[model samples]
Target: MRSGNIFLKRNEVVFVVILSALLLVVFPMALDSFRLNLVGKYLTYAFVALGLVLCWGNAGILSLGQGIFFGLGGYGMAMFLKLEASSPEHTAIQSTPGIPDFMDWNQITELPAFWLPFHSLTLTIVAILVVPAVFAWIIGVAMFKRRVGGVYFAIITQAIAAILTILIVGQQGYTGGINGITDLRTLKGWDIRTDFAKEVLYFVNVALLLGCLLLAQFVRRSKYGRILVAIRDKEDRVRFSGYDVSNFKIFIFCFASVLAAIGGAMFTLQVGFMSPSFVGIVPSIEMVIYCAVGGRLSLFGAVYGTLFVNYAKTIFSESFPELWLFAMGALFIGVVMAFPNGLAGLWQAYAQPWFDRIGQRGAPRPISPAPISPTAAPAERRT
Candidate 1:
């Protein structure tokens, strides 16, 4: 079927406009800098939810360990920032005046070879984009070629997350331990801690999110999207149709990983820190919950779901920190059981039909048949 446009339908284009207005215009106008910054942090997670929709929702590959990619990306960004923060002037008190404090604290005299590339901003950006893609490709090739998938794939991802988290925590000298890489103060000679900087970063984050949304839309409407749907519904049929199903799966998995990594990098920028705490099993599962609550099949729903869940988490945790976990559990259960399609499903079922009815009423009706209809019925009955 021909599309209304190359990427989005007319209505979808309108949605993009409306969403942009809401995020870029309305939000800044209505919120204080602090609150707006909080919302920006929430938007970072939307990247992961968006990725989840791409892979799990569209491609039908459930991964329970997205935090691995998120952490890696954040760490990539953090490494660069930490190097900047650890200038000799700032660390002159330590035995090694140029190394990160955590490294110095552990009595390490030199930076690790792996961290050398992050000293250059160009290489840091490249590493941020490339590392996650390569890692995901490795995982995808290893598993998909062997036909390992479904819940097994999910459990394996979880195991990987656990392993990565342990490694980060265990290598305290290099990784900063559980405390995480901190004291992040600036980027490229700009003070990120300033109010103006936070506001700017918030807008930058929102812009990236909107761009990613368009990217997701493009992918979903493309031929590749159709193939992903087919794979999800009938993988064996797709394979028999001469499509290399594993390659498609591997490509999408890499795509999703990169999205998560981008979010992680942005999270580091806006939040000013990165930690293994955000890289473990719990955070990974929470990312999955964000997608599930948003209606994984709906790209827009995935984003809205992230905002809703994170907002709820902030408010609920503020008052009842102890009970927040239980509340989260219940919320997930309720959304799964009652609104299986999530908020997007509700809109389609109730709101979309209402709009359709309104449109029909506004449209011109056909002229009624002449009065002969009644006379013909009587004549036919008498005959």
Candidate 2:
């Protein structure tokens, strides 16, 4: 099959089907509400990994500030939730009953102008989608147009992440400081904290993830995607071919940012909070590791990689908190050194071939007619 025509190849389709079944059926069935909710949170990170597969893996843009966009989206939703939770009835004892609790605690008497729109669910949803794209566009225009990339681009992005973290933490009154915009209780009058709500949100998260995956697959199989690969391999050649490479880079970067933002929003909904801890250098870099471990080039691998790494972290950190960092560092090193293409690469290299061989061996074979024409003719004559 032609390359683009086979975006969802037979094997890939099977993999996706099985993964969907596991995530949508098996996991929900097996895990308790708490564990399942945690899985939902991890799946949010998978969103960022999927974006990295496009921006970093395909286009060769390594952003170390994706958490910024994620935080933006999360904060957007959290703002609305905070507003709902801080209604006049809920915070009647506070000095500013209509404002968020953090604002009141910090001695603020009124809500900020920016926080006004968040009171409207429609506006909040729009902000969740638009804010990150706009921010990403600004960054992309500044960097890509100037031909800034490689380690320098990564450094700049990391700096942006750091700056955002500081701003969020420093503005204690406005942003809730280190505590972040927490105690998010409701979404348009629906109590998000309820177990039933969590289950519904998990399904919503999965559906959105699947939609994003399909979109990513479409982009990956497009002529635009090929151009991205070309730019990654040889920027000058693509530029020489009359393509405005920066435009493509900008668009993909913004696209990736939007995806991260959506994930962040979902994270807030599922986890019930948004914090600056998720908007800093460490989390941003960790997000990259997820893509790396999943096979940066593989979208499906990104999801599994995120789940596997997070699952390991949860188990190991609970048992050996002090050694968690060491384990993570070792895991990163092992992945880079031994399986550069990650779990997906490993499967493609070793497991897939073995599976194919096994399939071939186990396939039903056609049986030849016994004793040929002479024996059949004698039997017919006797009859």
User: All candidates' lDDT scores?
Assistant: 0.92, 0.93
Question: In model 2, where is the ten-residue run with the lowest total lDDT?
Answer: 1-10
Cα error of candidate 1 at position 242, Å: 0.9
Question: Candidate 1 lDDT, tens digit per residue, 1-383?
Answer: 23453468866776778888988999899999999999999999999999999899889999988999999899999999999999999999999998899999999999899989999999998998899999999999999999999999999999999999999999999999999999999999999998899999999999889999889888888899989989999999999999999999999999899999999999999999999999999999999989989898988888889999999999999999999879878888998899988888898899989988998999999998544455477767555
TM-scores, each model vs. reference: 0.94, 0.93
lDDT of candidate 2 over 1-383, digit per residue (tens): 22345277778778779989998999999999999999999999999999999999999999999999999999999998998999899999998798999999999998899999998989988999999999999999999999999999999999999999999999999999999988888888888999999999999999999889989988988889999999999999999999999999999999999999999999999999999999999899889999999999999999999999999999999999999878888888899999999999999999999999999999999897554555477767565
Q: Give the clash count for each candidate.
A: 0, 0
Give the poorly placed runs of model 1, Cα more than 4 Å off. Answer: 1-6, 363-383
TM-score of 1: 0.94
- Which residue pairs in candidate 1 collide? none
Minimum summed lDDT over a 10-residue window in model 1 is located at 1-10
- lDDT score, residue 327, model 2? 86
Q: Model 2 reaches what TM-score against the true structure?
A: 0.93
